[model samples]
Target: MKGLPAGLPSLREVLSRHGLDARKSLGQHFLLDPVLLGRIVAQAGDLDGRHVVEVGPGPGGLTRALLATSAETVTAIEIDSRAVLAIEELRQAVNGAEGDRLRLIEDDAMRLDLASLVPEPRQIVANLPYNVGTPLLIGWLRQAASWERLTLMFQMEVAERIAAAPGADAYGRLAVLAQWTCRADLLMRIPPGAFLPPPKVFSAVVGLIPHPVQPPPDLFRSMERLTAAAFGQRRKMLRGSLKSVGGEALLDRAGIDPQRRAETLSVEEFDRLAQLL
Candidate 1:
């Protein structure tokens, strides 16, 4: 592990050989710090024999860490052609046997049917692309049952929103959904200096373990609509924001004050309002 398997070069060497540089357009910032990568993997708990799916594995940094975990399978989805080739070199470099557990998919993560693409009993671990992180999160939440856990990296602000509680400055739709459906927590803060083309902002790793008792599917769908309406005008009163959906009368039935803003509503109130939709 000190160096790569026999003939395989180190990750840094591989990237250098391929002339790969992090792309700003893709929101790419390669996490080259091995220590940090290992820490992200450790936060997901035991991966032994578990299936793992990683998205946006730029140059196979975190993907390599995941493969080392002895997981039954490690699938990496990448949209960058250069990264796809780079990861291929990694599979051959690390271990031929690792290729048995490692898989590389050349496609955009946003376009994949994530649930069916990978084997079940899977934990999604990735340093997600900054561009599509939030939308991808919402997609996963809609089908939270498919994943056993999600250990993801995001801009610190986005991570804060995921683990934030009601009434907090960062709390909103993402908070309500993440909190209600998953036991969300912030594991650690990662500094910009950790990456190759270091991003301007800091990043954080967040762990989300789906709650055993999920909300009603109908209620979940309702919450989506309610949250959309409410947070679409987050600064406005619930009465004003809810108007597009129903208005103060609906809020009255949910037993929530019309005067309250979306940021003030707890997960329970949001779910209750969702029921009205």
Candidate 2:
């Protein structure tokens, strides 16, 4: 692992020099603690040969940590122009030591084709922007094979939804889809104070490693539709909730109880229902 280049400036100094403040419109909350940043990177497991992709790298706090790893490359995608300047400075600071290992892209993460951007053996690690986090994750899950692992930070509630079990209130479409495609876990809980200009809610990091065996494209689509109908009206019995998908007849076909609610069904049960579709 390459040490951070000598005389690298601190995150605060980077932000200050760039006159960058966390922007609520962009859902930006800069994580300024080096220890926490390192811990987040650790959650992604060994990065020795992985190409790390970071989104919304405000002032490149986590970017700095990633560069210190043995990761083959760290590609940061930032949409905010001002913050991009801050990260540019970081890129320059480490250019000598990191060489081609650090690449900065000033673009919106949601609009880019990630698979094409970062080749195989890729891992995504980021303190995701709050507003677009779930949407971005859902997109990635649809193409889970493209990534080796995903270690991301989100609001504590969102993290709970990702790792929640069948009987939990937090379990729903996200939990079903996420668990179906990958092994999801809430890795660490971070306090609001950990961020510069703290957010109102606590944040937690979630780690996801895709299962070796994944559903076929058709089955995955069926699963998405099934979860949408079932959790769309989560309080209703599966018979009523899934009426548009297939209703009680479909449940009878799959040997599931029609009276059960969406939250009560296991990932396997949902898969069973999806297969019938």
Best by TM-score: 2
- lDDT by residue (tens digit), candidate 1, 184-232: 9999999999988888999999999998888677878888888888999
Candidate 2 overall Cα lDDT vs. reference? 0.91
**lDDT, candidate 2, 1-277, per-residue tens:** 4758878788888888888888899999998888888988889999988898999999888998898888988899999999889888888877776677788999999999887887779999999999999999998998898899999999999999999998998999999999999999999999998888989999999999999988888888999899999999988999999999889999999999899999999999898889899
Candidate-wise lDDT, in order: 0.85, 0.91
Residue pairs in clash, model 2: none
- Number of clashing residue pairs in every model? 0, 0
Candidate 1's TM-score reads 0.94
Candidate 1 deviant stretches above 4 angstroms: 1-7, 216-218
Candidate 2 has its poorest 10 consecutive residues by lDDT at 1-10
